[model samples]
Target chain A: MMADAKKIVQVLFEANNIPIPPNRAAIFEQFIKKPGSEAVIRALLANQTELMEKWKLENRIMDIAQQPVRILNATVGKPYETWFDFDQLKWKDIAAFEFTGLEDIGLTFDPKTSQLSGVPAQSGDYKLLFRYRLQEEPEDAPYHEKVIPIIINPDPKSLWKKLDSNQQDPYWKEDDVTAFEPLGDRSILVSSKRGRSHANVGSFREDDFAFKALPGGWNIVVVADGAGSAKISRKGSALACNTVVEYFLDQPAVEGMAVFDELLKQYKTDNSEIQKKINQHVYNNLGKAALHVHKKLIAFAAEVSVPVKDLNTTLIFTLFKKYETGYALLSFGVGDCPIALLNKDVSEVTLMNWIDVGEFGGGTRFITMPEIFHDQKFATRFGFKVVEDFSYLIMMSDGIYDAKFVVEANLPNIKKWKEFLADLGGKNEDGISVALSTANPDIVSQFSAWMDFWSPGNHDDRTLAIVF
Target chain B: MRRLPVYLLLDTSGSMTGEPIEAVKNGVQVMISSLRQNPQAIETAFISIISFDSTAKQLVPLTDLASFQMVDIKASGTTNLGEALHLVATSIDNEVAKTTADQKGDWKPLVFIMTDGIPTDDWQKGLEEFKKRKTAYTVACAAGSNADTNVLKQITDNVVSLDTADSQSIAKFFTWVTASIGVTSTRVEDAGKEVTGLSELPPPPAELNIVV
Candidate 1:
């Protein structure tokens, strides 16, 4: 605390650019023992008034540097207090400490203890100018000053800004959408919500979906995730889903389904030749619908006078048919989304579609790309799954898939699927869950609310569809 | 969780001893404080610092904004940019998560390099190694006229030049960097997309000029 007279003199001498003389400590001790020693020291420095002023100004920085460095931090509306330890300063018998910067932050300072205390009213960096005077100094003496850095961090939760998207735009859609429709003996529920990230920036939710009950006990559900990098991807996604669903509502689709039913029954009897026929029939019908979607997007892009790339989006859908013996689930995907089916006991989970994640280092294959048709793996993208009875058939965009499954491989993991279902059953941080039951009329809204769960960095637009 | 990893490569050579070094320190402090106010950056951005002088050192490892602390750094010795680049590349491999069956990797890292002088070692070797690793964007800044922009050009196409290494210019650069990080964090969270070009970033302040 600079209690020794020798130490105080040495620091002052060094700051004033005065060369230290030999035996200076002994001289200082001898001088302090004499009466009027303070006056004597002051008189010696009186000739160099400029140096004394410089020392006073420089002492503040030196004092702060000599003390242990630590950031003084506070949060808005949070209580905070920090004491200025003046022991490092060379000034002896220090008195009359005052701080000038506390008023800006609505803090109070006690001159006796040299402490600043109060709740910070704002968030910002504050430099407190600490002023102090020597005990023997006159009332008109200049106060020594020190600049201390103080930071006030903001409450993160309050920083988020939610603004509405422009509805006047031609291709604008609602921030959220939900649907419930009966599909033969079963029903499908779908929910899609704009992510918080989008809501914060007033951007559109670039995800869309469509589900319909078709003839011949067939149900079709299609989901699309518009490319975030693309300009009009929302329109592309909407067109992709609608074109596929509109195709299935035609008579040609019914005829195609009839041919598939015949091939399915034949394949059950004979495994080799009939199985190949079943594959060809499913491709001819469902695959045709996918190709037609691509064609429709191109036409729309040309009609809208924008590049086809501007309308980039991903497409995934399932064609479900309920047979007396078992259920047939034929699915196709051309993006990072996942389609999965769970057994009744929830012990087994089967991935029903191909995903394009991590293929080209996190680049997804959009349905709008023409090269996908020529790619060798395009034929393998469609899959057929036959199960005795399943608990849930879930299909979602990358938003939900990336958040729940993380990577493509986890899409088929039994444990991950179980945990995902549990999250749907009220195991999430938000404590919002949706039951897969037709008895609950608010199932759609419930699913929408559940989509608002916080997942740190995964806030892309979420779209989920379940056939239960 | 996908983190928006940011790597800062700063030059602490002998020439940066006085005003430049102190400006750099203040720049980083201000950057950290400003980023803390951003909800998206607070949630996703993780930062690391690599300082290069006679040798390179990772002053800070990959740390989230909530707990990131800046250690004191002094300027001395020659500029060893090669070692700094190599260290950053190795650190990215060791620290960044990769997308596998087990986990989702962080978004491609964002790299920012600032220097006031030319390299004293064969930096091309480090560049070769750096090219193998993927990053969302790498922006290099040549502070003052002594900083060779051509050398930085070899490191990245996104290069900016500052007239001087004073506190005001450094502060403006740091503010631009903070805005860039905020834009990126929000972009990934909202768009599920990565920024691959300089056009995607916010324009630099008047104190900084693009080194085309």
Candidate 2:
């Protein structure tokens, strides 16, 4: 790496609203020298030109000190950081506005460092977002780029009129099946903020977590994440969430989690008797639809022909059935995720780290496939459980785990607790309030201290389900 | 898993003036959003929108469905079905070239060309270009009220009539397209699950009769 080129890199960061965090700019310079180096380096460029031309998105980095920096999207108006840490994702006054041509939007902050530069390409008025994770202190810099709105196409009024011109899909206004609903016995709290940072995209208020009443003296709390990258992921997540809950509710009132747990196990075992049946059923119901897509994509690949629809995305979800004896939380979906409990009323019974099943090793895998879903052993197992009224149970996707290298890591970072979570990894937070009411430090502080929880990079959507 | 690329070649010509064009436009957006919503639809279906009037233009370029944006198209100019067909074929050729021995990409390109007026440009060159079209794509032309089914047949032996380009017919075309796309992508996704790919596809929709 040349000396001046490195300094210019610093200027790049400074220009983009981020400082050349200590050793990071240097590492970035060296890293971008490989064969696909151009692509790597372009991601680091200050503007959206590189992103626009390459179709690569803007990214957010958590800790430069970490080996591999976590990256998120940069196309939206407000970065994912803004969503993750809205209050801190503030900007200086210039004008009230929005960005355009972007899709997903998010934002978060680093109280440890208090910096913000996330997914959104531009901001409301004029202010570029920036973070100094590795710097001694971000405020060390005298000035920051006030991110400004850029409208390459100003015909927005017309565009909006056309969009609302009564010539749209009936489903256009409906929460596209995968919209969020409430989960657990908890009352839902909903909020909103400008999403996608696009001028056209107004402030969005959505609640993707939901809970429904069940017949058998049980309350069902469900959290399902549509594959952010897959086409029908949203639909798949909706189907899985709706189907699982419906199936369980249909069964006769099972007294306890243990009872329901056993029935679930049996149902899964019975699934094998119809493995062929499940396979054929999946093919019969979803085959033609799936094949229709498969052929077009292959055709797209073959250049024989193609369509304008996208079909790649992944999903992660859970269904919690609250029974008298410890509620049973049944979770099955593609991709690995975070599952844990947090207690608000008392100090104990909150395990933010995932509770483990003695034999379960949860990294990341495709649980949406028919083979996996039909696997009685894997599918029927109640990987985690929750008893008591407690605060809430949190389950997040690879967005956080991937950024934290948590496949093998645990929460509230400490030796005793680490070993404890690893043992209770799959079911760490699923137990009853029978204990933990004895501990100190309230639930708010528990969250207050866990600052690095928002995954570093902003590549995928962040979904956190709080089942209280 | 292999994806089935479905190209929506829409006619944005000035002639698509009133209800028919609006219906077509609304129908396209509905289909895109619907496919995204249908758990039964996304196994491997991907879409691309190509609009043609005087010049064939790729409105939403060839990208995965998850990434492609559905832009608002304004009606203008003369019908250049030939030019659009040529461009679609050319785009397919270029994209297919990127496939390697290590991975099998899109199954087969499904080109749905929707037009009302006759081609104002030379379509023979496109017909010739498609003749050399490796069986990589299964081309299906849908004719509207005044559409040139004959010209469509020349491009691909099979031509589908979208009747009046009315909401109903547009819906029918989208259903067939969605069904066709889903089948192609699903077969490809399920294929990797086994040692052998599925033997064959059920014939296209009943209304989508194959032309000899």
Candidate 3:
């Protein structure tokens, strides 16, 4: 801190907003003639700056002291830069500006540009005390001090905790699962991962999925999302998915599908007579599977001595059969999850099931709700779609739907579906794509990693099954 | 981004001049600091403040947690709660984003009204105006025995009462408010639902009791 008489005088004159006289050289000489040492001169300059601040506040020349300070925003680990834009204050007319609290947050203030710029290392609210001298004020005018608040926000991703779920529980399920299976002409890639919200508190992943290749060129894909508030929804979701897949795997259900195959062939030729029979047959088969799940969940709840509502979960499944003409997709859903099929040209999407959303506001009807079984509209939850050819068929829990599509109306939107497909192809925040081709050896891991992509306020267990 | 809007309606009548007013300011400062540390609240919660004295005015517009600042307020004059409620309804209409077919909107606003005195104006008119707007939840606090809990009950079913309008009790109330906001922010995504009453909020401290 070297003290220069000429520098001090020049600063004082600029702070007073007055041009220096022609004899400025003589004025500087006279100003410091009586000073003893550098320390004393430096002390005198510091004292002047303080006095100027006091004088400015006392006069109320500006309302900076009387009003709330302007607040600036920043994020931890992100660069922050902003200029001083105070009301009724002219930047050029101020001189000898200084700032406090910048050093504590690893920020620096450059007086030349009057800008504060740096990367904040912490998250919190900080009030900066700014002291300055007005160029237009008298030499005896005190320096002005104004308070400005800067808030640094924490990175949402950084705040996430990733503790493993408890393995000691009797109904404990694995935190994550991924699979890549080959099905006749198409391949199925599935991934289910615990969301950040669940991982934050070491909670179980309440999503489950199951897929199986039936004997007669047919495939079944089931996905279930357990209610977050439900106590044992993890087991309920597992039972909901496994029960349906196993039902189709059993001898009776297999024979029933064989009957369905026969009915489909006859219905293709004779429209009216066989069409009615085919509808009845498809409904009976899917309905039986759903009932099996509902009954099994109730039994499981009783065995565990817990309320059935504790096992609440959303269930969606599709049984699609391939034929020389096209593909027949029969779907049933009892909740908010969606099953979608995209056409070969990617211009159209068929949402295969009636969604139980919007009507209840934010509540999703679950398979565990016994009252729905008696509703006549429950039969309408079953849907049938026949597509000539398709690019992809997908089934997902609300964890994925809420983040990707947001609402039920978006399920049938071709544009949203296209964007979602692009997102799967790696156009996401993480740039981790699930290559549709089976040739990609790391497809399963890639898909699982993609599930970890961050969407603020949308962390829930995710289960996605894609067929392409 | 869809935000969780929080409205704080504070009564700044003449009775709150000394320790009560200072406590209210400190309580708010503490609440802001605590919410910033919560991952759920930090990501979604946006806060606004309305202060009512002889008349009501919005002290701060809706601001995110990071940029929020507390301004000093001087307590004086009679309580005009009716004006405050009208301002809240209008601020919500102007500030909150409504969900539509095209875009996702903000979560329903959460309102907390704290007052130590009865309204000197026609509060029913303001209540009528406020009823037209939808909120996820509204909790009214009777700051002391002087406050009319019956009146607060008419404003909202979720009403709580405190023995005194002192620093300790008010501070505890704000802590409970902070916890309520934290839980609601997470619940919105965790269950894909909204909070509608005190049952959904955290339990109040010993200093506060349920009005009902």
Candidate 4:
């Protein structure tokens, strides 16, 4: 029986062209000494063909199972090209391949060569479904389908070029504020300064701010804090701030006011219902704007041949308009940047869009992050306020708040924040009011210096933009 | 946003007394000083330290690298590797934030274990528990000739051996650790990836060797 078992093993190895290693041969000899070895050998030989077939099937499935179609991102009005190749699928026996779901998006797919390529006509999410089957499988064999998502974005090359040119200028100093100037009667002060740590290392400031006076007393202010870890965050923050302001400035006055009017129409009749409607509309508009910035960053990265993640920054902006009834403030934020509305007396401060660090400490969402689309809460938050009288609106990066208001590395309540502001503003309740109302050029220097105030461990680039 | 958590498990048995323990302390300080220069590490790295002797104790809780301060370690008693492993498992379960439907969680932790003596307690069960929550990277260092390389191999594939626990050798080990961490932090920031293996580790000075 032992000799027969040995002979069977040799024949199996020979037929498969497999070498019997000395160690494996010794183990095989030891196995033959066990009881019932003859029955085991017989069963093994009888089932060898079936096992081999099963193994081949499993290996084929594994080869084809995780052949992922890379999700392609493209900008609207831009020529985009991408292909799905059968080579990556690694299924040699595939009899046929079929593609669906591209017709609606105006994309072309060739199943003969498993190629898909086209420019998406619109800006949104799309799924391309692909199905394939094996040639040797039964007529009723189950076909496998893969759904790949394609994201179409708005064109940002022109905007990105505008931003990139600014970044590349050798005349621009590393410590210079990105943009700071009073627009009109409404004193808009924007200032950004390099953090102490960044200065020590001679690194460029990653914070940026932009503001422009829109037609009809409407003002748009944007502040962006670039992620410290991102290599090109300086460019990211500059692009974010500029892109948001540009978007608001380019919008037709009527259309921009239409959003405010919708909120005003719903404002007091059914406060809760109106708030809900306003929140939804504001979220949609702001989310759209944020998505535009994200797409622009992606497009810019593609044009420059850099990873989009290098250009990650948090965005916060407010579009303020004065109406007969009162003033309407529409603010949106992604990440840890804060936007606040101060009462007429400057005694009370209300955080328009409040953001806390995510579940994990030291982590915040960026406009360019893919996760922003998956989770709406992290994508953007909108706050709408219609006030009869207010001192001014203040928007700032976390650097300012982390130093002054944050308690034990946690976000402080509105009451605590008001107190902190009062302290920074000094004994007079009018300190912040005076600072915002001042038209003097020194105010920019003062604000820039104020950001450098001593803080134990909070040393990040500081940016503050005030719309009065 | 998520932070990169790093854990250091040090054996504080009597075998690590005198200059060896002092070198460990200085090494930690060197790591802190070096990491402070890296803005990415300063922004994303969180650190914790655990020490084991007759019993195990968490010497430091998970704290941001910016605020981390080296705590002096005192060596005494037998090597209780089992207790240290159990403590690390518990701390990870308790301290590491988890992802939710609305927000992401912290990155997987990087763990380093340094021991100069064999365990005086049963360590298999504790190791099993820790492995169930496998860290992104786990590197074990056998600090002296008397240390057991075979047991360390069971814990992690990335293991190194130090010929002696002298101050210079320990300093070299810590410098390598700091460099590894610095590279990891940059990778996380630049590529948004949590590296699970050390493809390029700093070469060990003459006193140390890779344990295969």
lDDT for each residue of candidate 2 in B1-212, tens digit (9 for 90 to 100): 34556778888899887776777777775566555533323334567788889898987766654344456677899988778878877877876433343333345566777777788989788767766655434555454657777777677655667555666666666676665555554333321221111124344554444444
Question: Per candidate, chain B TM-score?
Answer: 0.98, 0.81, 0.98, 0.96
DockQ of each: 0.49, 0.03, 0.54, 0.02
Q: State the lDDT at A101 in candidate 2.
A: 27
Candidate 4 runs further than 4 Å off: A1-173, A176-185, A251-267, A271-288, A346-349, A354-356, A370-380, A407-412, A426-442, B1-78, B86-112, B125-138, B154-158, B163-167, B178-212
Per-residue lDDT tens digits for candidate 1, residues B37-135, read 888998889999999999999999999886676778899999899899999999999999887667767889999999999999888888888888899
* Model 3 spans > 4 angstroms off: A1-68, A86-92, A136-147, A359-362
lDDT of 3 by residue, A349-385 (tens): 8888867876323567999998878999887888886
**Which residue pairs clash in candidate 4?**
A363-B1, A364-B1
Q: List the candidates ranked by lDDT, beginning with the highest.
A: 3, 1, 4, 2
Global lDDT of each model? Answer: 0.84, 0.45, 0.86, 0.73
How many residue pairs clash in model 2? 131
lDDT of 4 by residue, B1-212 (tens): 46788999999999899999999998987787677656567666889999999999999999876456566689999998988899999999998887664334677899999999999999998898888885879899999899999999999999988989999999999998898887776666443456777565556567768888
In model 2, state the lDDT of residue A285: 27
- Model 1 clash pairs? none
lDDT of 2 by residue, A1-468 (tens): 345445555677689997656668567767546557555445555354545543321122222112122223233332243232323343222122233223322343444444434454432212224323212224344332222222111111122211121214321212311223344444322111111111122211111234465565455544444433344343344344455455445533233223544454333334666444433333332223223323333344235222222222233334456555545454433344545554544344433223221111222333244344355543332344444454655555443333343333344334433343342222233231111121323433332223112221122333444444
Better of 2 and 4 by DockQ: 2
Over all chains combined, what TM-score does candidate 1 have? 0.79
